[model samples]
Target: MLALYLLAGIAVCLYVYVLSLDGPESYYCRYDNQTHYNLARHFLDTSDWSALHTGSGAVADEAQTGYYPAAWHLLVALVASATGIDMPIVMNALNAMLSGVTYPLSSFVLMHALFPARRDALFFGAFTSVGFACLPWVLLLKGQLLANLLSFSLTPAAIALVIAYVHAGARRHWKGLALCSALSVGFFGVAHPNGLFTVLVFLAPFVIHRIADAITQSTWIGSRNPLRKPWVVWILGLAFAYLVWQAMLYAPPLQQVVLFNNTGNLNLSWAESAYAAAIISLYPEQPPQWALTLACAAGFVALVRQRRFWLGLPALYMLVVYGLCRCSDAPYTLRTFLAGFWYSDPYRVLCCAELFLIPIAALGLATIAAYAHRKIDRLSWKGSLALVAGVFALVNFFPFYQEPPEDQSSEVSGSHFVPTVGTAVGYMHYLMESGYDEGEEQVYSAEEQRFVRKVLEMIPGGALVINQPHDGSAFAYGLDGLNTYFRHIDTEGTTEQSRTIRDHLSDIATDSTVREAVRNSGAQYVLLLDQGLPYDEGRWLIQTGEDYEMGWEGLANLTDDTPGFETILADGDMRLYKITAEESAEDQ
Candidate 1:
């Protein structure tokens, strides 16, 4: 039975990562995957396990200094080193395994801990873990939120450990459980602090109920010191977890990286209607998938009908936290502070909601199976097989969840989550669509990518290549280890010379100041996708309009006729220009 469950997990992983598993390139290159891949590549190239900087120059001079959690990238680097696999392949496989295999096992552990006797509920829940598209599919692909993905995988295990410790037999070895719980939470906090928040918010009611039970039991026994309870063990365990987080914060390798950033309130506030939409669908931009949505409703009904208040309380409390996190722009300072704990991020809160929903959906499945078993006693075995088939179909083929109704044109209503097509023909079509440059979703055309590869082959390994962040050149660093000037969309901490080159590179033919800036900046070449389409200005994802303002326009104006530039390569609108060292020196 366990082997069967493991196979199911593997199948789930294969479904999502089939493209990358068979190919050398990573999927979802249009988003942050490039930056993350670059970080891992840096670790691999330098062989420095302690280094956190990517040398992308998105932050400070000649290096990226803005604080980002890179432990996830470090792990990817280590795995690639140990396995002798390519970094992109390792990233895809590791993510696939984490989300597909470990996630289901963790869910099983949590469900088993919650309802020890209900094997039907736990088993059904584990099987359906892959079907929650809001998680492994939608959220994973949208921003390629790698760090958040790690934390999501670890959260259920942490929650399950806490449950085990609190409910352990009096004679059982709880010290070990406490230690494990602390480590689970400590690792979770270091991976992504939002995960620690998820555990605390989800389990707050559980601990309070335990303490209340202790008080009531003591009162019935006529104990005078009811408030002076013996629940100090749990409190101490939590304190130890906090200490672990603090120690990791100041550790030798991670001391320089600030875990939190003061992200100001900009598009963080969730309108009431948007919040309602998210709750109903549990997805970012689309309407609810009625199949899973109805199952979740059934799970809620089962909890209430079965009088499972212990499980119901925490599940309900998570929704309350989800609601509170939407108050990013509330007038009350305290309420806003509550929202800030989550960075007022909607996706993080949605992840928290899914943690509880998985088990509830499983309960719904279990309930349906039970009713079917009673109605068809002679065909119980056959019915069970049919139920499994239905689950597999729903996991991969349910198509009722479409883009928001055409009439709906709200800010949050645009489609962001693209579901994986189960059929080979459909998947092939999906790939074709993703590679089409005419669409706003794709970042580069096939010709542009080929041009970039040829340019990388021509340039020496260490030579600096100036690039517009919105164009295909932004991927050069990660794609072929090229030294690109712009690592991300923003020029947050770039040097003055790089800024000057960004804003005036087109004037290299006429402006001595621009030529001098280029010479001082040590730029050897410029790469451009002059006629390429940028991402949609109206989309809620990373806004590219700022990229234009930052300098893409200046870079786009370069041509073969430009005096100080020599066209080294050109494929359609994509061009690579070599800087004329003679002109640069004369200008100097």
Candidate 2:
């Protein structure tokens, strides 16, 4: 049964990978393309698997500074080492495989924990394996899928460990369970801080159950106990393990959480929860109608019976989602929801709760079956209801497909593609090959292409080239040069010298100081866009220009421009500036 489930899961993963590679529109190509490219480059160049450190790339100035957990990176690096394949392709394939492994493993563990006495664990496992929300995010190429997979796999094992400790009343089991819990929590924390939030929410019910057990201990004295009481030993073991783990694994990075908080606020909205719910339950395009109907029936049963015990997962999920959505004053929109999703996506938390619901829904259906059996013909009624549920579950799995939208252009750039999803597939291959085929090679545009050609002739390799009149030109021409001067000025450790350069550029159109600052900043050539004057404050310098003329206003005051700087080439709207000096005074 497990083998069958594994095979099915792998088949689905491969299908999704093929779909992802179809186009950049289906994946998050633009949103995270630069970051993923840089990270892959780092892994290939330095052989360092730690995502915590910044990559040595063009975007390092803007990249996140904290350490990312090593799990995904290690997998990607291992694959690269073995096959000598491109890091991007390897990472995508690995993610696809991981996604396949998680669904069945999670379902099996969950069934074992929830229905240990039932002989039909496999049946329940299959039901959960096909549920709508269990592994929905696996379609994407993001870290979230990996994080979700780890959490799902670890969560069930942790729950099973806890159940065993409670039922066996053994000190050894309690110790082992405590250790498992700590490790699970640690991995969830490092995988994504949001996983930590979900883990806490899941544990809340267990904590309450423990307290209640202690308070009602006397009431159970005369009863035959189905579960054991090794509470004292378990608590002590967990506490000791937590202390050691905190000091060794969590402390270093946690200490800097406060530092990250200020810059981390990407306000999210409540609408995301609603959007996710709609997609999961009622999307007209690809509705999981059977699953939705089953969930609705189960929810009705839970609500009518005031099943607080069974409500733990759903209730906790609602609380967390509501807290994230309502706590902030951010505008309520899909973009906001996606932005704040970096902290945690409520859609994901709801998916985890959905896993817990399969059993609840199955049990509800089973109860009805048993009732009909007693009322009518015992065997026949029970068999009929079971058959109905099985049919519904199968329906949820069989179609297993999604259609490409009719309007491809409209679909490509929007929220449709998530960054992780795009990178996992081969969408990036198109981008890298669309214009320039060689790394650091420049492709010339008619007017702007001329300027680029000239600049390349003048500027020395590794020189700090700044465009005085075009900010977006470098990307347009595939020039790999520093272009985020305004952003760099806002960086945490902005030197006074860098700040002076920024302030000068802010009003470059009217300020001679701006021109001198540009000259001082080591720009050898200036391309002035014809659409904007040299004094136009709106114009920002860049490596390419669609319609610009070369200027030498700032060059007259500089001594030895030949060795320190020179205009090496020029054509139409572009010009090349070269730095001749081995070391500038400012650099010294």
TM-score of each: 0.78, 0.57
Q: What is the lDDT of residue 204 in candidate 1?
A: 65
lDDT of 1 at 190: 51
Runs in model 1 with CA error above 4 Å? 16-26, 50-66, 169-174, 218-280, 284-287, 305-307, 320-338, 374-441, 508-516, 531-542, 546-554, 583-588
The candidate maximizing TM-score is 1
- Pairs with steric clashes in candidate 1: none
lDDT of 2 by residue, 362-390 (tens): 55555545555677654685375666456
Task: At residue 289, give the lDDT of candidate 2.
Answer: 42
In order, how many clashes per candidate? 0, 30
lDDT of 1 at 357: 76
lDDT (Cα, 0-100) at 356 in candidate 1: 71
TM-score of 2: 0.57
Instruction: Report the CA-based lDDT of candidate 2 relative to the real structure.
Output: 0.44
lDDT tens readout by residue for model 1, 1-588: 355456766775565555423354544555676667777777776786543334543321554344456667888888988898866677767777787777777777787777788877766765556555556554465566788888788788788888887788523867777688778766865577677767876676567557656665664555555344545434654566457545654556442332333233223345653444344444434443445665667777898897555555555655554555443554434333443445555556556766777788778777777777777768674576467547645654443322334555344444333332233222322432343223333464445666777876898877888887566556666655677777676566677777777677888767778877877767788887654434442222254653464454567666678778888887766778898844666666
Assess the local accuracy of residue 500 in candidate 2 as a C-alpha lDDT between 0 and 100.
45
